[model samples]
Target: MDAAQHISIYSSGNRQPDYSPLQSTLDRLKKRTEENKVTINHTNTVVMHFCTSSQAVAHPQLSVGAHSLQLVQSTRLLGVTVDDRLSWKQHVINIVRTASYKLYMLRRLKSLGTPAKELRDVYTAFTLPTLMYASPAWSSSLTLTQQQQVERTQKRACRIILGPAYDGYDNALTILSLPRLSERHREALGKFGRGLLCHPCHQHFLPPDAPPPRCATRHINKLVPIRAPKTDRYKNSAIPSIVHMINSV
Candidate 1:
């Protein structure tokens, strides 16, 4: 099975970063691949440097053997687009565009006298998956505008399905027995949190459980909240956001 590998290099506190260690690691990897008679695809290999600082900083020039890897601002991994800044804006736009296109098929079906129930099923099977794919990873980080942008696609789908009787987005959801996109995102996060608790491999990703109170209290069951994040990006990241949700319940 082919897979992409990610290597993270951290610098000592407040010190100028070093690339020598990363370069050495790459050399060893190249050696191992050579021993196995596997050729590395230089063109597909690229570097993405992640940092929160707004100021421009010099990037390291990294090479594997004779091939110098290109630097990219963003790349797709496992169908999710991740930018160096981790803002998730580009990812949202891409999914929204794709979902909107899928709505065209729904329109074509409607014009053919398809039943409303079947059209709803088509939307669920074809378009909704595009919007909800990997939602837990990026949903909490979405700006209000981005969230609205995604919701519009569903609203359009509602109009296409209900035709003249469509009232509004919320009312249509109630009539169709469908949850709002934002509500679905929250549900996805909660389900993912439960899965983390049940799976041994993912348990390590969860924050530590709250210490037992000296005297029992109603809140004793909550997991410990993470330390206050230094940036909004970190605060709204999947792990921290999910911890907040779990504790609130």
Candidate 2:
């Protein structure tokens, strides 16, 4: 990490509204995540399975919830040190790249194009139990080619975010950054991966932002949906404040 570029440019880039230094860092799709089960020998007796809500592996819980947690936690430690920042930033970039590939792959799958509603419903149903990773999200029925792609992305996410050395598992960037008060906010996950706010929380971890469902503005938006909206009087314990932070971002 170049001190000049990393400290000033990197930190400042984070403050900018549309700045994305990560865009360049995230090149081709990363490698696949490892299987939940690690075979000690050729024998099938010692089998291990990555448990989730459903038998289907592509549903959407662990993929979304877990990933989000890792991202923010790493960001929280940014600019502090070299060894601390490297793996976190690398993992963050890797997860983002893998997640984008997943959305693209899902969208590209002709079978998934039956109807947007059905697709969404199927996703929700297959994903509900696994909502917090109680099931498998993919199927063995996919063509060899597609299976390879899913494996690639999943492996990438798993390796970097859920891998053996993922910075003590304290990611969750955007989610924890939400207000703690609102109870209606749902986890704002990408199509296939998680964000910081993995589960429901009544207040923003940062403190100043209103809860999720409530607007930081004057009124509470029931129609807006999602648990935990920010409150009108919400204030940030951090230096500038969430309002200021949001604007800066």
Candidate 3:
């Protein structure tokens, strides 16, 4: 099985993040691969440096043996497009493009007099999954505009299904017994947040449970909130957003 590995180094107060440690780690990984008689797929190997700073900085020159790895502004890992800034804009664009193309196929099926029920099934089976894929990871990071871009695909699908009696996006969803994409995202995020609380491995990712209130306050069971994030991108990330959701509930 092939897997992508991420190595992160955080910057301290007012200090520039360093790449030397990352370079050393990659050197060791190359050595280990050679020792184990495993070949590195240099063509597929690339480096991405994530940062929210506006100041221009030097890109790390990373290598595996004699070959220098390519530095990409964005890359896809396990179907999620992650960019250097972690804004999730590119990821949303890619998924929207893909779901739109699938809708074209759905339009063809509709023209052939496919049953409304069957068309809905085709959508639920084929297209909805495309939009919801890995949604829990990036959904929290989406801007209002990006969220609408995603929801428009579903709205278009509803129009394709309902034809003349479409009425509106909301009524189409209600008539078809479908929830809004934003609602689905909230449910997905909530479910994922609850799962993290129970999951043995991922539970550690959450903040420690709040200590009991001295006077038995109503908010005794919430998880401690994390330190304030320096960037909005980090503030709206899956973990932080989910943590806030869990705490509120």
**lDDT for each residue of candidate 2 in 1-249, tens digit (9 for 90 to 100):** 422212111312121223233222221111111143322121211111212223333211111111321222223223221122222233323433545444443344334444434433433333222222310111211234533443344333322322243332123212122121111111211211121122255234423333344336764322112234353212211212323333332
Ranking 2 against 3 by lDDT, winner: 3
In candidate 3, what are the lDDT values of residues 45-132, reduced to their tens digit? 8888776678876777788889998999998888899998878889989999999999987799989988778888999899999899
TM-score of 2: 0.21
The model with the greater lDDT, 1 or 2, is 1
Winner by TM-score between candidate 3 and candidate 2: 3
Per-prediction TM-score: 0.89, 0.21, 0.88
Q: Which structure among the candidates has the greatest lDDT?
A: 1
Look at candidate 1 and tell me the lDDT of residue 163.
92
Off by over 4 Å in 2: 1-83, 86-88, 104-109, 120-249
Model 1, 1-249: lDDT tens per residue? Answer: 667565444343222567788788888888998998777777888888766677766686889899998988988878999998878889988999999999999899999999888998999999999999999999999999999999999999999999998998889998888899999999999899767865667777888663333344554346778888988878988999888887777
Looking at model 3, which ten-residue stretch has the lowest summed lDDT? 6-15
